[model samples]
Target: VISSFKIADIGTVDLDTIGTVEAGGMTVEVIDPVADYAELMESLFDFDALRALFKSGFRMRFDAMHAVTGPYAKEILENRLGAPNGTARNFIPLPDFGGHHPDPNLVHAKHLYDEMMGPDAPDFGAASDGDGDRNLIIGKGIFVTPSDSVAMLAANAHLAPGYKAGLKGIARSMPTSGAADRVAEKLGIGIYETPTGWKFFGNLLDADMATICGEESAGTGSNHVREKDGLWAVLLWLNILAARGESAKQIVTEHWAAYGRNYYSRHDYEEVETD
Candidate 1:
């Protein structure tokens, strides 16, 4: 038996199955994974606090890139959290992602980036990848690098009910910047540097040694689940925003002032022939 995930591969499957899909018809038990996931998400934060952010008229724009997270964002951010209608854009999952790649980076999600940088931008803007594990964060006129995001999230995570006790430790992929390391230092918690994969962080998380883990690839999560969760990161950010009563830019600026900022960048090359 083979199990597959992510839109890149899953979209190719023959979804319309006839009765007896395989030898001796397999029983398909349908379940509402979205409701289950939404419940789990709500458990991780102070509901009233997050609702207050929206109640206070702080606008949020989440671009799903027409990928998997559209429904989840719609349910959590709009239905559950009381955000205004149309808060989640490109919210219908399309197999071909409307003829464009569904990566939530500046290159692919450029429309969202442009809107966030525009003069009439919302207070907060975010995007998630097709598979719904990676994310992109932009605030009004500022783009929060994944490296700095991890650090900032780690610093303010306590504002969320799930992490109110504080993080046990922080783990980052090897290529990730040392920004999180500074956060770990200031918090006096353990810091781990592992290879570039979620699997490596799993062990540390299971051991209770690391409460939060992240990669510069825009993946971030906690011990709450094994794999990185994109909406989870978004909700946590909202929880922090609500508790702080500050704009995304203000929080980021203050985080830099407190931790001393780290400037960094990366480049990727494709089709390089190696001997």
Candidate 2:
């Protein structure tokens, strides 16, 4: 297979293992085989589409981990958010310092939590699990449950850069807290509750009828991707920050002070047998 060959063994490989080749400085390189069709389709997204979307005020939310993909997502968000030179500090990338785990939570992501609570903290602070799918939302000294986060996004949708086009609908996973339903009710918009997996929301998002989808496990995203994204939620929070001209903490504090504090929490049990 193509993966079995070393960089130097490209030219010596037989036809069956060959994919593609390039020659430079007396060296031949073989390309890895295509992993999946969907990846190829995703690569077809053009830079101009991003530029146009950003110009029209399209934004992204995402979670940042220590992995390379996290930085890649940040770069994309900066470019779309009109940051100069494609650099922004709202969701700055922290190095894998002191063997830290990049998960986003009060228990596991203490560094980010501390910063968010401190003076001069970022307008928004967000983190992702190892794979950049899970998210934790923090605003000035408090953590937002994913249910509240997604609902807040819906309630504040019109304040986002591009959401003036208006949200088509809202959706949440079955286990998610029911906050978004209130937002939907207030806005006179549709709300859908599906199974735990994000894939079930595909039909709604694909229909251009839903602008946000979230799960109770700290996962959130918009119509941007079919999968739940931590960083995407972060960017959405920043979009609100930019629009409101408020710190993350201030915004959430105002929210709770007005909403009377839902006081939501979760408990998990391990190895429970269904039988």
Candidate 3:
């Protein structure tokens, strides 16, 4: 039920008929509809579902990549994810004034990768694809596989300052590694397995039955958002690491030792035509 908005076509509006003073200056015009219609349907930002996130104190940070939905997504995350004012950045249109394709892969997100691996790297770094649905997580010098990433978050959910309230439960996609399952088991909490999609996790989170969920594709979220979140996952990891007083590598290694290793690998097919 998450909704969004876009500021389409900004230009000058001729209001000569309104009889304004003769003074002329560059006037910026924006297109937005206050009412619903067949073509626009009153933009998703005008919905009520977002209020729930605000009520829950979930704040967000994102690596926006020139997508139309970037601004709207930021607004929702800030409103719901408890982001302080003026902290979000839409890293669109790169330094060269050219658009950068926003994909959350090691090679594709070169800028993000460098920043994460650089000397001044933030405690965490996350990014998403063109539409803001997928996610990639990096902690210090380590890049956490989405499967293990979500499991680690679930295992240490109570450590995050925001989630100190407590975690209700955890869930993951059927194809996701069993790391999260072990964490849930150890915590004496329930774990739900759904098909490989964010929609399935949405239903469980909406019901307040689960606190966190993730997929093998690197998407992760909690009760904070009804959709898979990129930056939120990154922040969650940072908060957990900060609270645990351990490096990301240490946390993962310790986790593997306790739950036994679940070595995971993936094979991707590209540029193939359907037979």
Clashes of each: 0, 10, 6
| Residues 1-275 of candidate 3: C-alpha lDDT, one tens digit per residue | 75987564535556534433323443443333211111121131222332343343433335666543355445544544345553345644344324555667776666767877877665555666665567777666777788998888888777655576667889899988888888888988889999987888888888888998988877887776577766556555655654556667688888889888788865555469879
Question: Compared with the true structure, what per-residue lDDT tens digits does model 2 show for residues 155-200?
Answer: 7767654576678899998888777887788788899999978788
For model 2, what is the error of residue 162's alpha carbon versus the real structure, in angstroms, after optimal superposition? 3.2
Model 2, residue 168: what's the lDDT? 85
Any idea what lDDT model 3 has? 0.64
Question: Which ranges in model 2 have alpha carbons more than 4 Å from their true place?
Answer: 1-63, 73-102, 119-122, 257-261, 268-275
Give the alpha carbon lDDT tens digit for every residue of 130-196 in model 1: 9999999999899999988889999999998889999999999999999999999999999999999
RMSD of 3: 10.8
lDDT of each: 0.88, 0.64, 0.64
What shift in Å separates residue 85 of candidate 2 from its native position after superposition? 12
In TM-score terms, candidate 3 sits at: 0.64
Model 1, residue 55: distance off in Å is 1.9
